[model samples]
Target: MDRRLPVAVSFMAATIVAVLALPLELQLAVLITTPSAILWMGRTTVQHARAKEDNLRRISEIEQTINEIAGEELLLFQSRHPNRAETVGGRTGMSAVFATTLNSLLMLLVCVALFGGKHGLTAQILYFVFITAIALDLIMGAVQLNRYVYRRPPMILLEK
Candidate 1:
């Protein structure tokens, strides 16, 4: 079972509630904050996936030695390795990032449509600063995620 499914759904639900519960000004702040949070989550997922993949490669390299060891010892080694756990955790992390990105973008659009036109100078400054920051964060995250992706298959087989 994909453990991430429930978590992804719950996050979506919570984000919806948060959006609905916030006032317009705070909602705008949330919209700005969400993208950076998503980016951070994405970076974490990529790092974990890389670490897991590295551990798996190292274990595989010593598979013969591991096989010669006692069953309990091999089991302990495998348990400590992040093979399946990484895959599971990566799925959840990536899903959360994706969902968060979309949620933030949607909220951003909504905020702009609702409260964009009537802003004072301070409000306008805050709006521009937030928009720029969010955009940069999203772009940086995309680059990081793309780094992992581009390392594997260019356009053919997509593993991990």
Candidate 2:
């Protein structure tokens, strides 16, 4: 499965909803799905890491055979390459999240300024949903950032 398919779907859904002026709650829910999925994926990654730790001996043994033929230096290089790539990807992802967070904040402020005075129930509910979704997005981003920044080193087969 394409890793980005969920994000693309979420973006497209949100765009279409906004353009067509769909029901506001549905719009907020659709927009929230992407960050919720991101948080779910992050949780899965953490679980996989824990499982790897539990089976570290088996993993190391399997990797040891490959390292023997490929050489330790090659194994080290291979490990470093993925780590570097992940770091770069994480940095890019964080930047996007930050921009989205700022946009959400601005949107929230505007909604409050424009609709706060009006006591229309639907508008009020929509505002709350929007604020909640934005909060969730920021939270998910922070969790992802924390995991990225403090990530464990890849379990290389051989020690330097």
Candidate 3:
């Protein structure tokens, strides 16, 4: 649902612009679809940003918890279970990757939609910038998740 909303809006915007940008002088279509595109892009970008922030926050809390656990407890866990790290890695990495991929694909869709189907090269630049923001947000989340999930020597370590 979250992912689909942005895609649908982008497609609709692209269709409107393509259809209206004709020499038919449909300025009304521009007035209508331009703001609609902006609104959709604005709302989707905010939603994506918030979701990315939330996921990063979770990863940070888990990392902090790991940092707090120390000494024999950490050692025992590490020794007895080698794959625990991978499980944590999968959990954090997967979430980040999922969000990133979703955002990236959406951005790509918007880009091509604008260029290939919509108002030529003019609006393409703006859409690119708009969609790029969401991509960056996704990247931010992935970086945070990686830092948390792949800390060297593990965030939680045994005190010698």
Runs in model 1 with CA error above 4 Å?
A: 1-21, 64-115, 118-122, 148-160
Ranking of all predicted structures according to TM-score, beginning with the best and ending with the worst: 1, 2, 3
lDDT of each: 0.53, 0.48, 0.49
- lDDT string for model 1 (54-135, tens) is 5554555466457567453554454455543444224544555555456445644554454454557788677767766765
Ranking of all candidate structures by their lDDT, best first: 1, 3, 2
Model 1: how far residue 43 lies from native, Å: 2.7
Cand. 2 TM to true fold: 0.39
Supply every candidate's count of residue pairs whose N, Cα or C atoms clash at under 3 angstroms: 0, 0, 0
TM-score per prediction, in order, is: 0.45, 0.39, 0.36
Tell me, by lDDT, which candidate is best: 1
- C-alpha positional error of residue 123 in candidate 3 after TM-score superposition, expressed in Å: 1.9
For model 2 the local lDDT of residue 73 reads 43
How accurate locally is residue 126 in candidate 2, as Cα lDDT from 0 to 100? 70
Which of the predicted structures, 2 or 3, would earn the higher TM-score when compared with the native? 2
Q: What shift in Å separates residue 45 of candidate 3 from its native position after superposition? A: 15
Candidate 1 residue 47 C-alpha distance from true site, Å: 2.6
The regions of model 2 sitting more than 4 angstroms off are 1-69, 75-78, 81-89, 120-133, 148-160
- Find the number of clashing residue pairs for candidate 3: 0
- lDDT string, candidate 3, 1-160, tens digits: 2465556556655655575356534643443345445445444444454455455445555555665675223323333444444433334334435544564555445544534424556665665675566556555654554454332333576899
